[model samples]
Target: MDDRLRERFAGLWSRTIGPTGAEAAWRALDAGYGAAGRHYHGWGHVADLLAGHDAVRALPDFAGLDHDALALAIVFHDAVYDTGRADNEARSADLLAAHAGDAAAEAVRAAMAMIRATAAHEPGADPATRLMLDLDLAVLGAQPPVYAAYAAAIRREYGAVPEAAWRLGRAGVLGRFLARPRLYGTAHFRDRLETAARANLAAEAATLRGGPEP
Candidate 1:
């Protein structure tokens, strides 16, 4: 999975990070994505985001955004995922910063910002940031079975926690998404995914609370 992703990144950023530097960064990121307990936040997630990005990258509104930064951010966003840590985003940002030394200054900065924003999936005013968030959370709006599989994969990742505790923690996270004025940040995603995402989140939250799902 990462081999192809690595190749794509190498091809895309060869000018900025150079071929050798790109190879090194890919090696580091490949290992990070292969980290233990990364059931959902692993290569599959990166692949999904990359595939989604391809669909939108050519869109006129997105064509001007920093493709290199967005691509790098997608790779590093969950690079530091650990079941025990709360600072995964910060750590991931640090990892990207450390490994992306040869990338352009602005590109690296953009990558770090997008990576850090994943901590809360906060909405941002800018189209670039909005697209990043939308791509990251696109799975929330996936078809029912796909979304269910994603939910289960996430539960497996947190298997260390007792069921009751995990339920409470996960429910709180879902509730916050529910409380958001909007789940999707970009107009493209908002139009295509918002309703499904809200329904999926709300239904899962209800199930966690032992109530009927909507």
Candidate 2:
């Protein structure tokens, strides 16, 4: 699977940025995502995002989106993830822009915006960015077992946090999402995932708060 993903990324780089720095960029990506402390925000997560992008690219609803730009953005969105950092998205966007150089300037600009959108998962003014946010958050609406594993992986990523602080912080994060009127920004995702995502957030928040799971 990693090999397949690496191939896809290489093809994207070649198409978007020519041959320059492609191999070095992939090596950077492999090392960054394969880091020992990365439990969730890793290569597997990148693969999932890319797969989701591929699944939706052909849909008429997303026809106006720049699919290639979205693909590049997805590939680099979490390329600099760190559990303790607040600027991972910014750093990742900068990294992509640097590697892309001046080639595909429009696409790179769009992709950079999309990459930054993951920082808050907010639906900004751009449709492509909204979709990117939705893709990053699709795990929120996963089936119960998958969602459980996702949540556990997140916990493991932040394992250095003391138990009490972790619980408080985790519950706070879930509470913010639960309080939102809609978890998914795009209508396609909202229709298909909103209910399940809400239920999952509520249940997880309850568990984190020592209340009964919903």
Candidate 3:
């Protein structure tokens, strides 16, 4: 809860979706998905991604884009996340439309498209989308303790699933993450964190497979 982040969120709230509506929407989302619920992809996760995106922006050669739109997208990326639901994106889009009006609604839809596109690791996706997706998955490259906590949070979010099913599903996700050429395709992230990210993913994958630490 940095002051700058709070200010930024307030600005984003006032700009796209009027202050009152944004406040209400955020409160609803916060109450439903905040830390108390142990939601892995909640406000804290969005805040982390926003911070990563800002860090990326400071790198040389980073072209400026629609910061507000991207910020809004990040906030709502997991707005409708449900471990048992297959239509999270659609549901998120609907919620954004209802709460934020038409323009913000469209932005949410685009964000949803970007999110779904990342699942396939599409080669032709836009650079902004790539960066956003990478930031979303950046937890995988965090320090072991941080990553372990993230893993536990995710497990809690998906607690409805049986342990065996959760393990297999999680392993499949890590495998897909490993298949990517670079976790973050942006030049800055590739230069600074790619090796460490790969090592982290590899270690996690090994642990998932019940192998000794690397």
Best by lDDT: 2
Give the lDDT of residue 109 in candidate 3. 62
- After superposition, the stretches of candidate 3 with alpha carbons farther than 4 Å from their true spots are 1-7, 18-20, 103-112, 115-124, 211-214
The lDDT per prediction is: 0.84, 0.87, 0.69
Comparing 2 and 3 on lDDT, the stronger one: 2
Candidate 2 Cα outliers beyond 4 Å, as residue runs? 211-214
Candidate 1 lDDT over 127-180, as tens digits, reads 777899999999999998999999999999988888888889999999989998
Model 3: per-residue Cα lDDT over 3-122, one tens digit each: 565567778878766656766777656654564554687768878988887776766555765556667767776777767778776676566667766555555566666655544545
lDDT of 2 by residue, 1-214 (tens): 4588878888998887787778888887877898998899888998888889888988988998888889999989988987888999999999998888888898899889888888887687788888889999999999999999999999899999987889888898888888787888889999999999988888888788784335
Best by TM-score: 2
What TM-score number comes out for model 1?
0.93
Ranking by lDDT: 2, 1, 3
lDDT: worst 10-residue window of model 2: 205-214
Candidate 2 has a TM-score of 0.95
Cα TM-score per model: 0.93, 0.95, 0.82
